[model samples]
Target: MNYTLHQLQVFLKVTETKSITKAAEQLYLTQPAVSIQLRNFQDQFDIPLTEVVGRQLYVTEFGMEIARAAQNILNEVQAINYKTMAYKGKLSGKLSITSVSTGKYVIPFLLADFLKQHTEVELVLDVTNKNRVVRSLENNEVDFALVSLFPDLSVQSIPLMENQLVLVANRDFPMPKKPLTLEAIQALPLIYREAGSGSRFVMERFLNQLDSKGTKKMELTGNEAVKQAIMAGLGCSIMPVIGIKNELQNGDVQIIPAEGLPQSSQWNMIWMKSKNLSPVAEAYKNYLLENKSTIIQNHFGWTEQL
Candidate 1:
């Protein structure tokens, strides 16, 4: 049987308020009209939905179950209409984005060009560490998040770029004539990002693979903090090459080689699988994929494996 959109909307409203009078007031319809629609809905299903206990109208158990299914069906129908409208290239809306701290250095630059092309679209960006970014995505707090390490989530992930993790030390610090392996680096005092930051996880996993537990470390929150600590001769630490571009160039820090480090680590753009994305967000995602390498080269002066 066919159900009208208005019927679904009215049904959801009544379920939300649990009172037909309140639902009718909210929907701007008379109480009898609301009751008639509800009864018609139940008739279509060959079942009764409401019962009277004294003067109060209460939902039947069957009605509660049907209300749950109605929500899903209504949502799917709305999704189809939204996507149909988006596919016609009528892109005009706001895009909300959240990203890990290092992504601040990358995503904003990419978005700038995207904004220039789509001048009418509004953009909102939030830059936080990995934990906050993940929590925001989980709570529907942001449309998309750029992260260096993949989050432990059941979200849709688009592989955007790969960043190399490198060991950096102050240029003035003493270094051995030979390259250091994971085992050798673990012996040195290390400055690192907080637990949830992607760089820390990558470095720690690399150390773990080499039989080092990674207990010889000091935790710093931001990229600048770790960079400054290393520049102050706080000992060497593994950091994202993307974050240390200027420091590496200005002779403030040195990139040291480590054995068994992966050639590069993968970074992903992620969002909740079940969430609906606006046309503007979908357009920006397309823009990022189309200009992935250029985005990296322009931001960090280095080519990225897209």
Candidate 2:
């Protein structure tokens, strides 16, 4: 009934990633080592923990229960370690952050200065869709999440920057010289993000407000893919201005002058209020609140008007 913390960590990683090989890579351990540890962990219990079917690992019900307990234990251990480091007035620990895909445009810039100042801190950034980011936060897997849409009232949200969504088309696409109406814009072939994306949610809400019944012409998974689709003349899309800065500067895409366009949203850094944050995470949060606007303006040349 005894299992080392390292074995539990390996088990948790395997369950989280659903791949022994991936867990090995992430833990920087050999695949055989991970497999051996997983086997040892399972040997401590009578019931089967996981099953492999068609090359995919699936955690059983008992395995899920154990995984949850393992995560709690791991979290508490980390909390204790961070608390100890705090008493020493030292800032040296890992900070795991998850953010929406569009956040890729901003979080790195926000982190650059912080990283330079705290050379001992390790930062792990995961860029995904809004839904996945929220799930990560809810699971306490990440210390903070950056998103445009606040999922619920339970988390502490710090508004960091303004995110503006704008209609963009390939520079070669025929665009009206004057601003188009909402209905006109709706008629154009539109490339859109997947349903779970915050950008898609905003765009859909905007269209719904206009009472527009038209459906998007194409659906892409990522911002980069949507940008590529637009540049390929596949379809136009409504995207966050942050993600299109490079393309706009290069004249690969142009913002369409549409009535009621440039929908404004807020970029919020969110964290579970009930959870205790490591010193590094707390410092990064404060840093974002204090310096995000200036850093963003300097890095992206965005004005308050945006």
Candidate 3:
């Protein structure tokens, strides 16, 4: 009745994919290795865990039940490792964050140092649209959220860095011979991010504030797609400078030097007011609060000049 954790892992993987070959590929082991582990794991149990018929692999009902138990064992093992690291006076736990799509450019830089310092901590950064990010935060599904659009939600935030959405177009697009004005920029066809995106929300706010009547071209989800659309001469868009730095530098796009832009907002690290923070989460928040300015100055000093 002796089966190793490796055996259990192989067993679970086989059950998941219903193929020893697939389990081997996913586990980065040879097929023979996986086969051996599976055989060793199954030797202790009399009931069959899997079956193969007509050249197809299948997990039996009992195999599915054992897979659940194996998953629980893996989970407990992970928890024990975190607890042991904490026992050694190291901050060890999960630091989960849900960030708006554009926040992808910023969140990783913010986390890089903290993760390096606390090697025992596990990080999960989920990048999605503003609605999902806010939903994850409000549902207490994550320790923190990175977002720009602060709707009417009961949350507290720590402002991290300046986020500016600027009007940009393909380098080959037509530009006014005169000064770049709101009217001039708005006269061009425009591309937009999807409705519930933080970028779109801010873009709408700026346009509404200026009473713009620009022709709307099309809407795309995610910053990269919008950037690509603009580069392909599809249309112009107001995009976060952070997400377009590479494109701007490569001459793929050009920023319109319109007054009152780049429309500015602070990238905020937000959390529900009543949620209790774990040690890892608290340490990360404090690290940002204390070192965010330094990190920005070091990695993003160029952003200040922009």
Candidate 4:
């Protein structure tokens, strides 16, 4: 009962990261300071909030319950702050967003104009695989998430632009003069994104539809790694066209012509439908919807696709 919001924040950060050191770094406090606040918080509750077993921290069931309540309190406080700012016609707050790895190629450009206009706003961008991004959105850990695949239908999504997945290989790799069948392409050694990647999900679905079990050459972590592996002649991969534009133009990699290739999917901006949007987030959502088409066309020269 004697705990302060700062203590709760420390506790929450510790629980989220499972490391006192990491929580301290994130909060810009000393490790001892974080430890002190956590100790005080647990003392107030007179309960063991966390336990470390074999060097890994685990939150107790009671700790999880309190953490949830703490998050709710923090959300309410943030909402109140946003409401006050809205009354003053000010748009200034931290905007937390997570995106699938390939979204790194597009989201920065999409947000450039908005960031310029809202000079006082700060951004926290987390680029990760689709699975983690979706999990974060489900937990209400971020305000927005950009993804190519829609895994959960419960969350509201706004379609932003189209993403094309193209088969790419090292420039020196042998290429057929004519388009190859899906089965032929599947027979080639394929560099693939790791599990939980949106690209991997799409690629798996495409391969399943062809009734072909593709040969996996290697499983890499991110798009950049996959591109590097392919360019080194490790194998071919299906990559987002947007992420490969430079390599495609520079002759470092070439798109392979194939039947039933170039899988098409849309990039979507998503958020939890049950959560109340802060004024800043609502403004950003409107901004993205209003300017999406023009932005994509102007930046990527995909006007015809629209």
Candidate 5:
């Protein structure tokens, strides 16, 4: 209770590494300094933090609980630091972002443009599947995430762009005369993104509502893999209209009309409501708002900026 955030941080580092010396090395602190801080923190708690068994430092159950609390405090303190830096008009702070893999095709370019505009900001990006992005956001592991149709999380999402999900097949495939129903689409072999992905989640929900037997005939992890499979005529796949502009233009793939499908999904910019935005985050958000159409046009080579 009487411990400073610095001391709690040292305690967490020591607890995680299980060695005062190793924690000091990782934190760029002297071993004796780390040891003293841990001792002081333990004194405040009036409990033994670590026990030496076979030359390995082990955190007691009580100590581990304290460590968990310490971690939350440390995270809040870091968030405060980020906000203070922003308030000072000094846009130099770490901005961590996690996004779905399909975003890999677009987000990197958007981030690059933001960095070009604000060279002072440090950006770290975790490009992953949709579920991991949502998990990272919920756990406070990242500052913000760009994802598609996720559940209503404890955070807020600002939708940047609304995009249609199009059913794509190789140009050689037979074209249906009318807008296809879920049953008709389900009759074709389907290539799908993994289950937890935002695209897959939206597609599944839409299909489940329309046809009880809807299922993916094949699964692929990345957008590139799905594109390759669809191009090879292995199966039909659904993706954002934005994602396959090049393929569609080149006549490599064709869109299959599907009725009763959701009209569009948003490319959302999301952050925890309780967490304050850093200056760098604000800058990036502003950049996205202003240049979203340009980025979309550049990515898709659209004649008219949308």
Candidate 6:
């Protein structure tokens, strides 16, 4: 009962890292300071929260239960702070969004005006692969997920804009001497986004529909890595033009003109339908729905030429 939030924070960090030394480094405190706080916190509990065996720190089962409760307390404290700010007439709260890696190209532009209007809002964006982004949404770890692919999940969507995927290769790659055939294009070295990527899923589906089950010569985790690989002439890949606009314009890469190329999908903002949106989340959702037309016109209208 005498424990402070800082002690709880220190204790939680220790539990997470399983080492007071690491926790101190992460928390930016000296080892002795962390040890003092940890000792002080454990004194409040009836049972020992942590133990050392063979130089390794371990949190006891009671420690885990305490840590869970501590997390809830911290979450409540954050919620109270957000509420206090709202009452002062400045739209403020944490706005956490996870986007598939390629979405880095688009989400920020969409967020600019809204954030400008509500400067007090805290923004946390995680740009990872689609699978991770969806996992965050499934666990309700994020308020919204920006994705181009809508898979089998219980989620609602707000259509934002068109996404264009095109076949591209290093600018120095030899132009096919004749009009390209799917087989001929498939014969060339090809790179792919790693498995579990939304872009890869779409690309694979598009290729399957064409009956061209081409094997990738190499696979990379992100758009930037794949871009660099292909630009280094490792192979060609079907990449979102959103991610490759600079390369496309700079002539570092060239689009491979082929039939059924430039596959299209819509980038959407999706969230769990069963969950209630917080004030900040709801406000952002409405802002996106209301301004998507302008956003698309300004940011993505160039995809039309492809």
The root-mean-square deviation over C-alpha atoms between each candidate and the true structure, in angstroms, is 9.8, 3.0, 5.0, 2.9, 6.0, 2.6
Q: Across residues 65-121, which tens digit of lDDT does each residue of candidate 5 receive? A: 989998888768777776777687756677899888877766787788677766667
After best superposition, candidate 5 residue 155: deviation in angstroms? 2.3
Q: Quote each prediction's TM-score.
A: 0.67, 0.85, 0.74, 0.86, 0.69, 0.89
lDDT of 6 by residue, 1-306 (tens): 888999989998998899988999989999999999999999888898999999999999999999999989988988998889988988888899999889999989989999999999999899888778878988888999898989578999998887888888899987765656677667778898989888888788777765667767998888999999988988888889889888889999988777777788889999999878989999999999899999889888887776
Q: Once superposed on the true structure, which residue ranges of model 5 sit more than 4 Å away at CA? A: 1-90, 297-306
RMSD over all Cα atoms, model 4 = 2.9
Candidate 5 weakest ten by summed lDDT? 297-306
Lowest summed lDDT window (length 10), candidate 1: 297-306
- Candidate 1 error regions (>4 Å): 1-90, 210-212, 215-217, 297-306
The parts of candidate 3 lying over 4 Å away from their true place are: 1-80, 210-212
TM-score preference between candidates 1 and 6, better one: 6
Model 4 / residue 285 / CA error / Å: 1.2
Residue 276 CA error for candidate 1 (Å)?
Answer: 1.6
Highest TM-score against the true fold, candidate: 6
On residues 240-280, what C-alpha lDDT tens digit does candidate 3 reach at each position? 99888888789999887776788888888989889898878
Error of 4 at 261 (Å): 1.9
- Model 6 quality (TM-score): 0.89
Could you give candidate 2's per-residue lDDT for residues 1-306 as a string of tens digits? 789999999999999899999999999999999999999999999999999999999999999999999989997898787777768877878989999999998888878988998777888999988878988988888998988988874899878778899989999977788998878877889888998898998888877776655457999999999999999998888889888877877999988888888898898888998879867888888888889778877987753444
C-alpha positional error of residue 275 in candidate 6 after TM-score superposition, expressed in Å: 1.4
Which of 1 and 5 is the better model by lDDT? 5
Estimate, for each residue in 17-134, the C-alpha lDDT of model 4 and write its tens digit. 9999999999999999998999889988767899999998899999999999998999788777767776778797778899999999999988999999987677899998777897
After TM-score superposition, what is the CA distance of residue 270 in candidate 3 from its true location, in Å?
1.0
lDDT: worst 10-residue window of model 6:
176-185
Which regions of candidate 2 deviate over 4 angstroms?
Answer: 1-5, 40-89, 303-306
Residue pairs clashing in model 6 are: none
